[model samples]
Target: MSKVTNLNQFRKQQARVKKREQGSVNAEKFGRSKAEKALQESRATKERRDLDGHQREHDE
Candidate 1:
């Protein structure tokens, strides 16, 4: 029989390939809705504003 030095390496490579294939399938299947997109943007904006407010308070 041939040597199998690194089974872990083979498993990792398989996992990476599988993950990429699944990601592509998911991307095609259920993309974001407009409402979800808007909600995400709003949450990001709110987080930034909160951070800025905290920085301003600390600077004073």
Candidate 2:
């Protein structure tokens, strides 16, 4: 005897698997680690501070 499957459940399961596969592909292509993000943020902050430090103040 052959087993029958629930069509709606089977379709939902397949969609979940496809979504997971696409997520992994996108992550590998565009994702960055926590450390890399923090390092870049800190560098930007420091650059901004340095530029601000070089600006002149005017007094009346």
Candidate 3:
């Protein structure tokens, strides 16, 4: 004989597990530390500055 289970409780537990899984996926996708973000920002700024420095001045 199989053990009896409450259907409603089982459904809720399934939903919770799915939600937790989604949360972890999202965390991996979007999680970043402040230092990491700052480093990225600084790199971008330096790249932009370097690019701008290479532009030629034109007089009309």
Candidate 4:
């Protein structure tokens, strides 16, 4: 019984390792370019500014 439990745990760990390897491969395959990274940062900054403006309006 304990052996079976240990086997199950080992299988689960193996599956998780495979999953992380696949995720890393996929991330490298579709990694962002510099332009894309800059665009994302700009959009995030705009969103934060918009949220701050809205909050200030509500406080007034």
Best-performing candidate as measured by TM-score: 2
For candidate 1, lDDT tens digit of each residue in 1-60?
988669899999999999999998998898898999999999999999999888744454
**Native-referenced Cα lDDT, model 2:** 0.99
Clashing residue pairs in candidate 3, if any? none
Decoy 2 TM-score against native: 0.83
How many residue pairs collide in each prediction?
Answer: 0, 0, 0, 0
Give per-residue CA lDDT, model 2, range 1-60, as digits (tens): 999999999999999999999999999999999999999999999999999999999998
Of candidate 3, the 10-residue stretch with the lowest lDDT total is 25-34
Off by over 4 Å in 1: 1-30, 56-60
- Whole-model lDDT, model 1: 0.91
Per-candidate RMSD vs. true structure?
9.4, 1.3, 3.0, 8.6
Q: Residue 17 of model 4: what lDDT? A: 100
| C-alpha local distance difference test of each model | 0.91, 0.99, 0.99, 0.90
Q: Which residues of candidate 2, in runs, are more than 4 Å off?
A: none
- Candidate with the larger lDDT of 1 and 4: 1
Query: What's the candidate order when arranged by decreasing TM-score?
Result: 2, 3, 4, 1
Cα-based TM-score, every candidate: 0.45, 0.83, 0.69, 0.48
What range of 10 consecutive residues in model 1 has the weakest lDDT sum?
51-60
lDDT of 4 by residue, 1-60 (tens): 344458788899999999999999999998898999999999999999999888744454
